[model samples]
Target: MLSATDIEVSLAGTPVLKGVSFHAQAGHVTAIVGPNGSGKTTLLRAMTGDLPYRGTVRLGEADIAAIPGWQLAAQRAVLPQASRIAFPFTVLEIVRLGMMASAEPPPERRASEALARVGLAGFEGRFYQELSGGEQQRAQLARVLTQVWDPVGPEGPRWLFLDEPVSSLDIAHQLDVMDLLGDYAARGGGVIAVMHDLNLTAMYADAVAMLAGGRTMAQGAPSVVLTDTTLSAAYGCDLRVNAAPDAPATYLLPHMARRAG
Candidate 1:
């Protein structure tokens, strides 16, 4: 499990996050839902120790600051939204880079397996930059999957920190990615995803933390956190929630408050 405590963040002389705290539990998905400036991404960066912030983060009860780089790399993996690469590399080569942190890691098998997991079995030799946006995102996911997936974990909790995992992905790919995340959690991994899509979050997340004004306004099960009241307050927009008759899931969409005409 991963826990963030009293986290405060500032970027370029401006405060972005204020004393944020939360936990990602094993066998569960904790989705961070918020508006554009909600500090969701900042909190994630802080949790992964990728950003400088004031707080204490613990991975499975061990102080994150105390853990060595190689050790932390093995225990947790972070998949940022996207990165700018100067040169294009083959997809296989890129995903295989994830294995650099492991000791005596399997090279081709790891890359191939991760690619296949992301539905990219034969995309090994394709140039990363040539792929479509969704495909490129999936490739990035393959790279992260190659790093984060630990099939056997009688050892320690595996944590995955993802920022907008489903952005720009088509509906099918979005569901596919969520399925993969659910599978990972079911197999004992923990996931914290910062997503802008609330409907998808309601469908896939076990718990949601709604951030507003750089703080968590609500954090609890989907049923409670995805309500119209919280949605309107956190997003500053009116929305409606409807439960499907066939499933236990709920869906959210804009209410489009009418102007006084």
Candidate 2:
């Protein structure tokens, strides 16, 4: 549903990404995972078309840049890591704003449904700034959810980009958000997420793109990408990756930090 071909980026004359290319399929969850400074955030921005990037990015049949800004909002909904509003707006107000760029109606009824989807139903009238970080993240997810559902008509596929979506949440909330992502993909929406939790990615993502030093080191099924060699190289520590006995994927164990912690 979404792809980047030989894409590269630089900030202040220093390259941050070097010839990255990958595709996110429809009805599947794809995750970008790496250590700090691995260009995860840069890649997410490149996907969103907010930053200048070399090479081609295609969202379904049309070039990503060719899509009009207003139209692009309907084609894709983004929940960036920096989804904070300085102005004092109600949670519902912020959610409706996400649909403003959309071509659909003010998503009021849809907003409540979206809030409930993320388990934040009664928080409609709460101030955006008053909520905790995890609550705010769910609020942002509610906004994106409205956009996704709003564009579910003839538009067909809608792309969802999430950058470190679980950074603020406790374990339960993190799982809550991940489950929502899986549900979105299962419903035939395309999901591309930037995640730091390898275990979460393993549990949720159908495919994994391992990025390091601003380049894609590997991209494929979770078991292939989250290997011992790749994890050690990317993280500068010894690690082990083993299959989960109860599941179909691998689980990463950081032996070094496991001992330290």
TM-score, cand. 2 vs. native:
0.94
Q: Rate the local accuracy (lDDT) of all candidates.
A: 0.86, 0.86
lDDT of 1 at 23: 74
Error of 2 at 231 (Å): 1.3
**Candidate 1 Cα deviation (angstroms), residue 140:** 1.1
Candidate 1, which segments miss by more than 4 Å at Cα? 151-154, 259-261
Minimal lDDT window, size 10, model 2: 147-156
Off by over 4 Å in 2: 150-152, 256-261
Residue 61 C-alpha lDDT in model 1: 73
Tens-digit lDDT track of model 1 for 173-251: 8999999998888888888899989889999999899899888888889999999899989988788998889977899
Q: Each prediction's TM-score against the native? A: 0.96, 0.94
